[model samples]
Target: MPDSSAVHFTNAFDIRSVGCSGDPTMFEAFWRETGDAAELVIPGWQTMSYFSDVGNVCWFMEPLFDQQVRRLHRTVGNAAVDGYHVLVGTGSTQLFMAALYALSPADADQPTSVVSTAPYYSSYPAVTDFLRSGLFRWAGDANSFVGDSYIELVCSPNNPDGAIRDAVLSSGAGKAVHDLAYYWPQYTPITRRADHDIMLFTVSKSTGHAGTRIGWALVKDREVARRMTKFVELNTIGVSKDSQLRAAKVLGAVSDGYDVGGGGASRHRLFDFGRRKMVERWRMLREAAAASGAFSLPAETSGQCNFANETAANNPAFAWLRCDREDVEDCAGFLRGHKILTRSGNQFGADPRYVRVSMLDRDDAYDIFISRLASLK
Candidate 1:
């Protein structure tokens, strides 16, 4: 009733999508800083690596598959699940489609209503539309469902705005699938309880290996897991075992404390460091934006949306700011001219005054952003 359908452009600055945020781990600089000068070991392994050529699976599949799944298990708290299946796609975007197919019915009378919380991952509706002709409807308000819906896709530390809500798993009529694409230690503290039976994760956010095009799902219900496996089969037969192994190697290294996301002592240490940096950067960005007095952000510099119970985010990687000023019609272009590329909030079903800002980047980048915004005043 509050006209929640409209989103603003400034809200885009609040998310860490690819390229914009610039993951240090993914960059060569990160490895250089770690003093690992070796030129990618794994002699015969990488040569035989069919992660790119997933369709070309040979005898090296099974063992590689085992190694990868185990590594993933260890990384994600080692939850229990039988029948290890791996499917590699171009990116987690493909996996998102696979998840939808696994849940939606082909011949159901009511086009399965796909519901995700407000200010969710921007890709949810896009993927759903491309995958299913049926279309995904957004669910507004935490407690109140937008419409009568069954399948719910919720993102922890949601995109556009890092709002991590307390969602539970209730079987039968109410089912929830978690899009935990950003559940890595560097982005946010790992506090999500595996108490739920169904969940999903992507290598892009966790490993900074978005190019690998690999991701996996964790489900408690044996039947649901089986169906999901079947969905993978239908999508592309199976994920590349080579990618699985590679991911496994990296995950193993992470579990063994060999290669952490932020290269800090523990995942917590990495998270804390990122939190501090994000807070420092946000302080400057917020101040600059505040000078205009046209933007609104989370109460705490921590970027925690208390409404979503996103307490774990001491400081969100991005800043979700809203511009309530009556003058500006286009916030995205306004920032783009200043060389600050951000997403428009309309895509998130929010007001036009909102724009998202990625706070997790080099200090220099943040400084430039603040300087640009300050110039606007």
Candidate 2:
């Protein structure tokens, strides 16, 4: 198999690949400007308490990190964190599992079903079912399921396809968890403030710092917050104090870029930089797709962006591409044959005609992808 598992740099950075990696070029410049803002000497004796709070909800979460989270939300105007308890995790994935644990009926004898709409994040089924947890089980698509004792995951500005979504099951017994990972201004318009009982956010998507592994949840109920915290406590004991500290600094820098906007070398803000790159990449992708006549893409949508102070459209993180040629049975496999890599639609519980392509790779890989795609007959 030519060691396809590993990336081999031959003639170019391969565009045939995974779901992530938005260009980090701007983030590099951001750090060069703001890296020193939250310097921590980490005295060997500090954070030895193994706790940031006794309550366990924010146990390993640094207080300053908490403050920065609040400040950043205020600056962005995307989410409302006031009166909401923040639960920190290694990443939103942990918080997601914790939400399932908290929402599932503790008294139920059988596992409570957890679900989302079709074309859900590909990993949800595997992650939810992996444990076969007595507390919860992965039930596909909320639209089909007719049972109670269910927890619905709502990924606004959803994965695989970028459509905004809400709880379809409206059953009195169903509880909804909003995954707002891509609700930030860079990916979508901040049309309104989200005040959900359980909401997840991640630095990986928000600020292009996936390697840091820091994510948080906003909980409206104290009991649910406590339960989610207990799951986190048992899962990792506590999130890394070091990571929390670094994230606080990075988040603070992001807020600064938004708040204190002045022209020149220091003018680059995280969201602005990300939005610009994404907009340009989307334009090019659309152009290539139209030229190819071999592929079809999602319809474009636009709205009034409250944060950007102008009308704008959503720029999805991943491109949901479908092969236009009826001869192609599987879009992902067809792309593979063309030396392009893509995730199959079946992973998201969709048909084989559709595939998912990351629109966030570097220039060379993206250019190669566009050229090859446009050349397709």
Candidate 3:
């Protein structure tokens, strides 16, 4: 038999090519650079160790778990998680799969179509199909002919667009599941009085705590929560206890004003600073794209929406630009050659001329990006 390891199997389906276009955050690379030198976590997480045994029960986590759940709900004004009793998952991504399991019906009508707006989080379609075994389909745009009996996936301040969908104030409407992954006190205004259950968020984006792989789900129904918990129990045996403990510790410390001290500004301050920097970067890119006359962006920023007031008050953090000129074939590859990576619009079911630029980089790097993009013309 041939040596299995020498088959060069990666060429068959280069999974790395997916999500490979964008420039990863320096922080992520830095964290991985540590290479197990010390515990990868906030200072508070250093207090806890991953030594929990399997035989032990989850009784020790009752209080902290309750606190984390309540804090998430109160901050987001989404009572769905409170109603369902969120089960701690390995990460929000795991919760996402659990949600698919909870919502998907093997014998149901149409095999549970998963729909969302354009320029969505790139992983939505892949995760849905991967976890659902080709049962789930990416139905684009809830308003654009999404047949009945479909679950729409919505992301607020959406991954690439940073646009939040208009929320439905009432219950019993099965439009879609909203991913409030980036919704937080710092990024969005908390004017919510009604809780739209079926939302997922992770500490990765919110607290820069990606390594912990900690995430939470909010839903209004006990049945949904219980079902999701069941799925979690089957996958990875109910997450890691030590991860939970460390997350709880870090959350408590941060809420009580203890900084992670990760060589950046405080949580709120860092977010605020990042937000401002993103807005500035957006302007620079918009100017470059416009100056090149080779691209056009979505009108969401200038279009009518609840965030109209907010958009007017503040600049956007994402640049959803599209290349109208026929010369450009792959926006991502074209940008990559310039040493500036961007997400291809095709991945989000958008036009190839379109590219999504994340504005989360530091001001200096962002400036370099603007210069390079401007020179492309």
Best candidate (score: TM-score): 2
- Judging by lDDT against the true structure, name the best candidate: 2
Model 3 stretches with alpha carbons more than 4 Å out = 1-62, 72-84, 106-110, 131-141, 144-146, 167-175, 257-268, 290-293, 298-317, 362-365
What's each prediction's TM-score? 0.72, 0.91, 0.72
Give the higher-TM-score candidate: 1 or 2: 2
For candidate 3, the lDDT comes to 0.59
lDDT of 1 by residue, 6-33 (tens): 3333344433221244343322223344
Model 2, residue 183: distance off in Å is 0.4
The lDDT values for all models are 0.56, 0.82, 0.59
Q: After superposition, how far is residue 79 of candidate 3 from its true place, in Å?
A: 6.9
> How displaced is residue 154 in candidate 3, in Å?
1.4
Q: Cα RMSD to native, each candidate?
A: 8.9, 3.4, 7.7
lDDT ranking of the models: 2, 3, 1
